[model samples]
Target: MNASEANFDGIVGPTHNYGGLSEGNLASTRNEGQASSPRQAALEGFAKMKSLADRGLIQGVMPPQERPFLPQLRAMGFTGSDSEVLQSAAREAPRFLKLVSSSSHMWAANAAMVSPSADTADGRVHFTPANLLTTPHRGIEGPQTQRALSRIFADESRFAVHDTLPMQPMFADEGAANHVRLCEAHGDAGVELLVWGREGLGAYEGRFPARQTLESCEAIVRRHGLSARRTVLAQQARQAIEAGAFHNDVVCVGTRQALFYHEQAFEQTARVQDAVRDAADGLFDPVFVEVPASAVSLNDAITSYLFNSQLLEIPGEDRLVLLAPEETRENAATRAYCEALIASNGPIGAVEFADVRQSMRNGGGPACLRLRVVLTDAEHAAVLPSCLMSDELYARLCQWAETHYRDRLDPADLADPQLMTEAHTALDALTGILGLGGDFYAFQRV
Candidate 1:
């Protein structure tokens, strides 16, 4: 999510985010010394990422042309020497296993965490199975994706699988593709593959209809058939007045679906709500989390910002971690949800309010950036039983970074071999202990 007080003039900005390539990025070439320009850095990173993909070290990629922001990214020194890029991608492999679903760029980039979003990292997987066709954007290209995939697969020791449905035009029928990817994801680890089907969700990009999303949900139900236990919740549902549901954006703990007015109206509020209910009914048992009347309105909250509250649907007794800035005024309802986790202490864990301001300045948040590499119940039981260890990877990498590179190199210079090797080693150790899954998640470009 782009902060309101962001330095738009810097390498990162709306222009880059919206797929616009600018002179600022590529204007400065590698003719300079050790420091690289944003475009140069991104290109270097992609070159390495590509190598990893070629070797099958990582699973996904992002065509450079489509990114448009590549030129600016190059300036940031985000890329690495070819070998180092492969190592970096290899180190991140294990973390992508836990992811089941994500937004087009959001999940692929792992936009919230400290790791590189354009490439794969913990909790973010980008590769889609052959069953799922990739969507084509304006400037993104094949080599970009190929290299990105290589970077994702760079580490031979770490492996993961991701099932992706093809990105068909909004007007095309993608139900079959959606069903196929979902099935693949479902069969593996707890991750569940998803499609941006429009069935009942409303129009997206003014293309795919709400009906398509609903239809996709329906397909999931019909194919897998809902589990015996499934609960539903509404975005505006309020158990109490001020405490229950806040008008601002909030996520439902049950369904793991984000609900709010999109850029365009979805027929009517009641209609959208009804569609949600119907979809729930068709797919799983309904336990609607009611949305209060006050919550009703037309506005678009940064969808990428709602990861912790919206996307996570952890099962009972399993802890859920949320890392956010404490100073930021969190929504009351969202706070309540976190409180619920704390109150349970029922093996359902929660880590609250970690300060990552500098990280956020780079663009991303806890969920936006972090990808969970879930070990099987068997795997978790074997290694560190306590989830706390799982949470320490980020900090551990930070410590390694501070001791080895931070004092000498800028955060943007992480792609350097000597510097990033420390990071890669730290990550390698973490993934080894954590044990990422196979065919459950992938790291690829969009």
Candidate 2:
């Protein structure tokens, strides 16, 4: 089962905006109520995917979920025609309306927990949509995400699409944001690392909620039918969480044989790495790059998202490349450490910066904007063609974004009937472009 991991980035939606909805995510809070460029956001996201595709890496795209969630408002007791619902909700519960319109799904890493065939019991790749019970806005993404994933990975023989976990606090899950997979090679058996934070209350009060629970991770492992021997569970440090590293990916990321992390990433960083090393024995030599808190503090790591950079094996080199945000290059401390890390000639050979500041301004970095799925050639080919990245597809997507997405959106804009219409019109065209059926989105069904 020799394979390659494809990076499936979520195309930023036409309603992309900063509502500062995420309580624990510092960037989101800092940029709260700010005007955003939906068009620029989508273009930047596509560029990142195209960059990877041009580099000859397997690259894919995840469609964004529909926004201006009217159904949610209806459930909350606002009822009437589509425009009426938006108007009433806007007039009565303006804040709630803004929360529903958030395009947080642009950060695709939270879309699902992926288990490659190499790690699953059935030898079939698995996709489980996240419940995202940690936040009010994100919690609504599950049902639609489930439908979208099942449509893309529909083949029964090669893919298994699991239902989202119940939206409960004890079983809260943040998808791939709290999960990582490391292997000697894409095709080899690997270790699935699940990171949990704050098992109980009075647990190092971080002024933010630790989204993923130990119970939630365990539930996913069982549902995915992963081998316990090949699994490593670690607790996220409260220090990192308080510093605004809400998800584990914000402080660490792993791919193939390399694990890039910050010193304060986990509660017992040494033991966590030791466990990973032991689990990977006979598989591949694990490469560990730890940025000591002395060189780059947790606050800097979260602020710049240096650790959130993608650690992809370069096209023709033995070393990895760090696909980071421009913020990392501009930040004094992170930039210095990044330069020194590459100069050290370690597993990381070079650092490439992408301008994804739109998403980054709302708490998502490069790694946060994509979901990693390891697929065999057959499995890869089985996915919908439009979901995969190609030159023709890239050009088409760019055109689509420009025509459908707005140039600017503010909190007040969430209530605009035209914004809702624009999102629906865009998603409608998108379904056809991606070969997703007419009924893929809620608006289409209407």
Candidate 3:
């Protein structure tokens, strides 16, 4: 199989703001009501994508969803014109309006769970959008996300873009944010590690809500037709979830063969490791970079997002590189651990820090900004060329952000009709630049 791994990052939308809509995310709740810079956010995200592309990694872009979601409000029983919909929602249901207007889709990691061609039954890469039933705001993204994924993966011969997993709470899927894939190379048949936050059908819940469910993980495995031998399921530790590790990507990130994670990432770390080794018995030996709690306390790990960084084998170097947020390098404890990690004779040889403060303020880190998809040669070619990162495309996108995005956005601005008009106009222009058809978005279809 001529396969390659592509990281598709969501473009920060024009209406990007600090809504504090995610209940389990510390940063989101802590930064509520703060003004946001959409231009800066998009620029910073673009820089991350460009850096990966510069290192020879294949990078793609997912367009942002429409914001100030009047369509959703109308569906929720708001009447009259779009302006009335916004005003009535603002006047009668302000909190709900704020939640629905959130631009949380920028965290593309939650977009879907993907199984590569090497791990699929029909040799087609499979995509199942996470139902996101735990969050009412995010739950609305399912249909649109499917539309976008279907458009991007239009070639059914090479891809299988399935609908979002069932919308019920029992099958609440959080997509790749809670999943990990490890293999010798992007083309190899890798081990798929499904991390469920809690038992889907279990009774009672934790202090902080668990977003992914065990039943959802099993459903993904069966639907993807992943080999039972190469698949392993693990539950996220209750402590991690309580500590604001809402998604597995917040506590661990696996790339190639290295499972870079914190000591408290899973409920039974040793058992998970053993299962990984057993699954990869014939494929290859797995590299485990387990960061002990004493080295980086659970608090420090969550605070600095040390484990949430992207751990990948540098395209040509073969040595692993950790692309983390500036916070990881700025936090004294996490920075120290990062230095020690690279200094040690381990698989990780380099650490790169980026200024993604805008996204971080909204509870997104480097790894949170991407959805990794391993695609074969033909499958890769089918991706929209304009969405791929290059010097030219990066420059264009930077210009697009500067030209269309706002300098500062506040929660109150969600009610502004002018803002909605501007967002629609900007997204309309974006379709042309991304080579997405005019009808790629819900609004565009209207």
Candidate 2 per-residue lDDT over residues 166-232, each given as its tens digit? 7777788899998889888889899999999966323444588888888888888998889998899
Could you report the Cα RMSD, in angstroms, for every candidate shown?
14.8, 1.3, 1.0
lDDT of 1 by residue, 1-446 (tens): 11000000001110112111111111111111232223232222233223322432211222111222222233434366444433443355311210110112322222110111112233322232221222222112223333333433443223232322224433222221121111112113121323232434344432112212443333333333333223111222222112211111222222123232222222233654564555444343322233233432211112223222212323342443333333222545444544653575333255346343222332233332222322232322232221122225334423433343233223233323453344334333433333432221122111
| lDDT of candidate 3 over 258-331, digit per residue (tens) | 89998999998999999999999889899998889898998889889887788776767758888888898888
Q: Pick out the ten consecutive residues of candidate 2 with the lowest summed lDDT.
A: 198-207
Name the lDDT of candidate 2.
0.89
Pairs that collide in candidate 2 are: none
RMSD of 3: 1.0
Better of 1 and 3 by TM-score: 3
Q: After superposition, how far is residue 411 of candidate 3 from its true place, in Å?
A: 1.8
Model 3, position 198, has a per-residue lDDT of 77
Q: All candidates' TM-scores?
A: 0.38, 0.98, 0.98
Assess the local accuracy of residue 415 in candidate 2 as a C-alpha lDDT between 0 and 100: 85
